[model samples]
Target: MRITDLNPHGGIGANSLFVELGPFKVLVDAGMSPKHEGNEAIPRLDLIDREPLDLILLTHCHLDHLGAMPVALRNHPNVPLVMTPASRVIAQRMLHNSHNVMVRQREENGVRDYPLYRRQEIEQMTGRIFPLAPDNPRFFSSLDGDTMTLTYHHAGHIPGAAGFTLEYHHRKIFFTGDVLFDDMQTLPGATFPREQVDTLVLETTRGASGRPPGYSRDKEVGQLVQAIRETLEGGGSVLLPTFALGRMQEVFSIIHRSMGQRQLPRVPVFASGLGVDLCDYFDQIARKTKAVDFRRQILKDLKVQRLPHGYKPGQRLPGPAIYVLSSGMMVEHTPSYIAAVNLLGDARNLVAFVGYCDPDTPGGLLQQAAEGEYFLFEVLDKRAMLAARRMRFDLSGHADRDELLAFALDLEPRAVVLTHGDPEARDWFADQLRTARPKMQILDPTPLEPVEV
Candidate 1:
């Protein structure tokens, strides 16, 4: 088997992989980088010009995985896109939203290459996509007339996320896209194959961090509730910066349940426009696919209001409101980032992060800032003191290092390839895997580099 890392910058952004098993050529998860602009943000699809792709498999609809699909489809016009049935609707909606964002950025940020792919192109590609039901083996034939079987497993990271297995020529390979082994408020834990494979392609997102002793999901949830309750009861607003898709829904579910149990004060819960839109989509997903355990009704019952407009930075917002906004990393121009500047100067408010934040992002910088240090918001030309409390919860959507290692070893694969992590994170996994079983082959392929398995 030949596998190449298609992500140009490597690490956690623009994740795409080209794998060849016997005669079958497969492209997994064409993605665009969040930190980059225009064409550079996308995967290096030029490398695959020599050979036409036979098929494309989408593990999930996260922007890093689904954002570049229309671009990839344009490159390989004949390739048929495949994904779990649950990802069908969300993928299209996300692509449309992405196009709108691109159009907006083209004007605001002066990114001339914005709207990389047209909406009509996405519509054309939609007709070619086929949704495969999970946990069932389906046969696909390559150009050379070789047959391969594909099966997908539920990956607990987010709604519609999946880990897939490939069987060809008596060799089996498994690919775990962003995965979470533990369950959350709105999703169940992963249910992957507990069998042997020839190769295991695993995500190393959390390889650098270990779960603290006595750390459990329930305990963390309890602590988060306690913090929010304390802040709200003290006449201070709480802001949770989260991703619009999965993290927003999960946090809402937690908040809703906590309020029902009378653990949280019933204050006005505010959400960004995208968050409110996703609630409807998630509701449809829950009713149609049952892939997630979310109900839009709860959000409505909680009185989740659309975030009010005409608010300027440094102005004190109406007190004791819980604001759930998007752009989890608090990127410039995002609702969360703008709100941060408004809320951070107040000693009474709390800004809590409920998901992973890349070290280079504004969210990470704020987390590392001292309580009294001044932080800069470059784009907005604003500066504020770190007066409000900032806290990070262990509500990540990826699996911990130990759990990932155990899963890789349990597969008993001959070779393992690490993806979706920073250099230090990947190095940690490489060291631990080598120490555990020196005979096993562990390959951390550099960007665009091919490795033979």
Candidate 2:
């Protein structure tokens, strides 16, 4: 078996993998990097520009994993796309929003290569997508009499996220896309198969950090609610920078339950962007597939409002309200970034982070900031004192490292390959795996480099 990591620049951006087993050639995902723009942001599809791809599998609908699917289809126009039924429904909406965001970027950032694939391109390829059910394997054959079966399982990271296995000639390889094992408020945890496989390809997203002893997700969530209560009671507002796909909805559900139980005061809840629009899609997924527990009515109950205009730093801004905004990293020009400038200078306000924040993004910078340090809002071209209290809750979407290590060992693979993590994170997993089994073959693949297993 041969596999290539297609993400150029590597380490959790533009996540795509190319696997070649006998006569079958498949592409796992084609993602756009949130950290980079235009051509630099996508995987190196140029490597397979002239190659024949039999299938393009989508692991989920998050932009980092599903963003460049249209471009991949445009490149290998004959290839069939595969995903979960929910992802089939969610992917279109996500891709359309991605196209809209790219168009806006073209005008705002002048990255001429924005809008990498057109709307018609997306529409043209819809007929080829197959939404297969979990545990049911689909067979594909090559002219040379080679047959392979593909099977998917619940990954439990987002509404439609999945992990899959490919079996060829009795040998099996399972790929764990972004995964979470513990159930959250709105979604159930993973229900993956426990069978052993020949090769295991894992995602090491949370390897670098270990959950402290006695840490509890419920306690963390309660603390988040407590923080909001204190902030509001103190006549301050709260800003929760979240990923529009999964994290925002999770927070909404938490807030909904809290308000219903009278744990949190019913104040005006503010949110907008792709996350808000996705409420309709989540509602449909919930009612139809029962994969998620979100509904559009939650917004009606919360009275979520679009942020009012004219929020200038150091001026009076929205008061005593809870704000949940997208671009979890607080990327420039996003709602969270703009709101941060207005909220940071005040001691009465609070900014809480409930997910992973990359150290390079503005959100990460803010997390590292001191109480009175001046933070530069590069896009706004202003520096403000970060007096607002900031805290990080342990509500990560990825599973803990120990849980993943135990999971990898349970698979009992002859060889292991790591994907989707920073350099340090992958290193930690490698070290632990080596310590556990001194002679095991663990491959930390270099980007664009093919390794035989």
Candidate 3:
């Protein structure tokens, strides 16, 4: 088997892999880099010459894993695109939302090549997506008369996220696409097959951070609740800048349960951006799959208020409430960025971050700023005083470093390839794995580089 990393940059975003086994050539994912713009955001598909892929396997509906599916499909229109049922629903909405964003950018930001793929193209691609039930093995015959089988295991990062197993010629290969072993507020952790494989493609998102010292998921949630209660008691609002997909749904579930149990005050909870649509999609998936215990309609039962279309930022809120907005990193022009400007002048208001933020992002800069300091707001081209309370929680969707290492050890694969992590994260995993299994072959290939197994 031969595998190549399609990302132009070796780091996390734009995660795509090309795998060639027997007579079949498969593309694992076609993603876009959130940090880049226009054509630069997409994977290096030019290298593949839009070749006719035997199959395209999508792990989840997250933008970083599924954003560029329409672009890939445009090249290989006949290729069979496969994913979970819930992911199919989510991916369609995500792509449609992304198209709207691109349209707005073209008109507002003066982007020349904004809309990479048209809405009609996205619809065409969506129609070809084939949903595969979890744990069901499907066999196919390759061009060379070789039998190939595929199976999906629940990945547990999001509603329909999955890790896939591919079997061919008496050899098994496993790909752990963005996984989490610990349960989240809305979803249970993943359960992988115990059988060993010859090759393992693993993710290293949190390898550099490792496990938090004396920290657990329950403790993190408790801390968030305490912080919210304190802010609300002080007559201040809380702003949670989260990703519109998995992170948004998870945070909403937590706040809903906390209020029901009276662990948190019954303050009004508001949601905006594409997250609101994603919640609806989550509700649909919950009703269809029963994969999660969504006892009641989350938006209705939790009483989440949707922000109106003409609502202006920094406008006086009715009272102490919780606002969950998108663009987790607080990118320019996003709802969280606008809300932060309005709330930063008030000492009582709090902005809580619940996931990873790159240092170059607006959210990371705000996190680093000290109280009473001035931060330049690039979007508005002005500087503002940092006075709002800031807090970060370890409520990540990725598996802890120790959990990933333990899983790798259990699999005992002949070779391991680490992807979807920064250089420091990959290095940390390499050193730890080398120490644990001295003779094990661990590979971390550069972008566009191919490794044979």
Candidate 4:
């Protein structure tokens, strides 16, 4: 088997991998980088532009893993796309939302090549997605009369995230696509096969930071509740810069349960942007698939007020409430950025981040800024004084470094390839794996570089 990394920056962004297994060629995850814009945001599809692809596998609907799918579908028009039922629903909406964002960027930022794919194109491409039931093995015959079987296991990262296992010529290869071993507020942890495989393709997103001492999901949630309660008691609102997909849902669930248990004050919770629409999709999928133990009317039952479209930044809410907005990193022009400007000047308000933040992003800058420091808001070309309390919780969706290392050692694969992490994260994993399994072969392939197994 031969695998080539299509992501320009190893596995950090635009996570596409070209895998050749005997007579079959497969592409996994065509994504766009959130940190880059225009053509730079997309994977280097040019490397495999001329190669004939047999199939495309999508693990989830997160932008970094499924954003640039239209580009791939446009090139390989006849190739069948495969994903779980929930991902199929989420990807269509996410692609549509992405197109809208790109259009706005073209006009606002004067980006000439923005909106790389049109709405009509996305609609056309989504028609080709084939939903595969979880745990059911599907067989495909290659041109060389080889029978290849594929099975998907729950990944526990998102509603439809999956870790896939490919079997060919009696050899099994497992790909852990953005996995989490611990349960989130809405979904359970991953349920991968315990049996050994010949090869393992693992993601090392959290390898750079080992698990912190005295840290647990419950503890983190309790801390977040305490912070929000303090802010609300002080007559100030709390802004949660949430990712529209999984993180938003998790936060909603957390707040709901906290209020129900009286751990948090019963303040109004407002949700804004595409995340609210995406929640509708989640509600539908949860009812149908039971992938998560969620109420079909959870959003309504929780009494989450949908922020109106015309709501301006810094506009005083009715009372001390929790504002959950999209663009978790607080990218310029996103609601989170706008809300931060309004709330940052208030000492009583609090801004809480529940997920990863790129150091270059507005959220990251805010996290590092002192209380009285001035932060430049690039979109508005203005600077704001920071006074609100800023806090980061250990609400990451990836497995902890030690847990990942233990998982790898248990698998005992002939070879392991680390992907979907920064250089430091990958290096940390490499060193740990070398010490733990002296005989195991660990490889970190560069972009477009193929490694044979």
Candidate 5:
């Protein structure tokens, strides 16, 4: 058996991995990298153009994991795919939306374009995706009467996220698809059953540095609530720029729950744009998961609208409201741009960041802003404005140090291969793991770099 990476390893984006075991050729996640001039970074995987792939397995619906699905399917339309049921739904939405953006970006960037697949390609991808329900055993019959039993386990990173195990030819390989830390709020933590394994493909997004002992998601949220309350009591609006999914729902639920416990003031808590739709989506998901109160509260608050997409200053915000808007990183098109333009220079308003941001983005600039640096930010490409204090809190969706180490130690696999991380994070994790298990084989290959087992 062999595994190969097919894109650059550093910075975010363009994630593709190919695995081969006897006659089985499994292509894992294929994603777009930020470094790609446009959509060109979506790997061609032409190396396997002539080889027959047995299956394709998706980690989750994140663009970096499934961005190249359409292209892959166009090149090999008959290959079967597998993922969690909820991910299949999100994948279709995310991919179709991304394809639109890809087309526009390509045209704007003046990049050489090819005959890329269309929305129909996304539909075809969905049609072939066989749901691999958690803990259920399914057999993939081999050409020589040998069988591969595939199992999916909840990864606890997002709703419907999974870590999978494949038993083939008496060797077990465990794939951790974007594992999460114990601090996550919305989903349960990842579970790794003890099993003998030859290889463990893990993610090192949060494994480089160790977190302090005794950290709790509840404590973090409590501190954030206190901070928000202080800002609100001081007569300021709290501007939380968050991703449309995951952290957005987690933060909303946390704030709603805090209000229920009387731990928060009844500020006008609102979310703008597609964020409104996501709440409904979460409600539906929570219902399926038997989450009673969360679903009811989210459904009840469906009517509360925040400031709309293009509100300007002197145009008035909807009172002392707490606005949770989309495009978490304040990427140009999101509502955060509107808020930054309208709310800047107002010492009373606070822009609180909750996730990672690219350095080129407005949110990233806000995060890296110095103490005396005056930010001239713009919304709708209109007049720029200056802002006062901006705050950032690490409400990440990835696993922390202890959680990463715990996963590796608990699994006790024969070898470990790190993927979906930058070189620094990957090296840091591999170095840390060596101290605990010196004999374990650690592989961190560049895109298209293959490893044999």
Candidate 6:
């Protein structure tokens, strides 16, 4: 069996992997680095005909992991795709969003535009998808008279995310798509049967530099509540910029739980477009789970609030309120951006980030904003400004260093290949693993590079 790192091997985004087992070719993911043009990062894409691929296995629906499906499908039209139900739904939306992002990038940057694939191409790709529930194993296809079985296990990074186990050509390979080793504080924790692997493809997104020993989600809730209470008492609004899906719902649930316990101040919480959609999705999930069934009722009772996309400027937020908005990275065009501009005018207001922020994104800028950073604004047909403080609180969805190690150690594979991070992160992670397990082989390859096992 041979494996190729398509995009995420060297960088922080565009996590795609291809596997060649005899006559069959299987693609684990097809995302390209966001910085790449038209999903054309891998040079080999143009060289291969569509007939070689037998199957496509998706780990999740994140744009970085699944965005290139339409592009891959355009070249390999006959291949069948395997993904979880929720992943399929979310992937469709995210890919559509990616098309928009790409188009906007082309128009605004004045570059000649050539999309990887159009909306119709994504639709064609969807027809080839076959949904798989957690822990179920199915035959992918027969290539060279060898049958391949693919099994998906939960990875706990997002809803319907999975780590896959593939069996064919008398070899077993495991892909740790993305993982959070600890019992989930948001989504359900993952479990992988230890005896099922020869090659383990892992991720080192957080690298070996571990996080500081911190409190649980509930404890973090306490800290946020304290911060908000103090800030609200000072008569300022608190703006929380979060992701539209998993991260947003997790934060909303935290607030709801805190409110039920009377630990949070009575403040209005607001959501953006995609954030509201995610909330409804969570409401459905909550209804099915006995432990979280009360959440739906709580949300119904509170009906916290929502900010319309067309919300007018000069609108006042309810006093001492908290607003949860979308586009977690604090990039422009998100509701959080509007909220940030509206609320930042008050020196007393705080913009708190509760998730990961890409350094080039607006949230990252806000996080780095100092005490005197002048935020420009317009007031009554005149120029205005406000000085704001950026406070960051960690509510990360990815596994940290120790969690990554523990997960890999538990899997106990013959070989571990790391992906989904930069060179520093992958190097540190490999070093840590080697120091702990001297005999194990850990590999980190560059993008589009092939590895033989």
- Compute each candidate's TM-score over C-alphas: 0.97, 0.97, 0.97, 0.97, 0.91, 0.89
What is the Cα-based TM-score of model 2? Answer: 0.97
- How do the residues 100-147 of candidate 5 rate in per-residue lDDT, one tens digit apiece? 666776675565552255777777775788887788878997666767
Supply candidate 4's per-residue lDDT for 163.
94
Candidates ranked, most accurate by lDDT first: 2, 1, 4, 3, 5, 6
Candidate 2 global CA lDDT score: 0.91
RMSD of 5: 2.6
Which candidate has the top score in lDDT?
2
| Number of clashes recorded per candidate | 0, 0, 0, 0, 10, 1
Model 4: lowest-lDDT 10 consecutive positions: 292-301
lDDT of 5: 0.73
- What does each candidate score in C-alpha RMSD? 1.4, 1.5, 1.5, 1.4, 2.6, 3.3
What's the C-alpha lDDT at position 55 in model 5? Answer: 79
lDDT of 3 by residue, 1-453 (tens): 999999998888899999998888899999988888788888988888656688999999888888888888888878899998878778888999888888888898887778989899988876788899789998978776888999999999888999999999889999999998888878999988978999889899998886658989999999999999999999998999999888888888888888889988888888888988777778778889866644337778778887546766556665588989888999888888877777777888999999888898999999998999987777677666877799999888999999898898888888889899999999988898889889888999889988888
Candidate with more favorable, higher TM-score: 2 or 6:
2
Worst 10 residues of 5 by lDDT: 290-299
Per-residue lDDT over 1-453 for candidate 4, one digit per residue giving the tens place of the 0 to 100 score: 999999986658889999998888999999998878888888888788888988899999898998899889888888999999888878889998888888998998887878988888888976798899789999988777888999999999888999999999899999999999998889999998878989999999988888679889889988999999999999999999999988888898888888888888888888888888887888888878877655637678778887755877657556588999988999888888887778888888899999989898988888888879888887776777888889998898898988888888888898999899998999998998888888888999888889998
C-alpha root-mean-square deviation, candidate 4: 1.4
**Model 2 segments more than 4 A misplaced:** 309-315
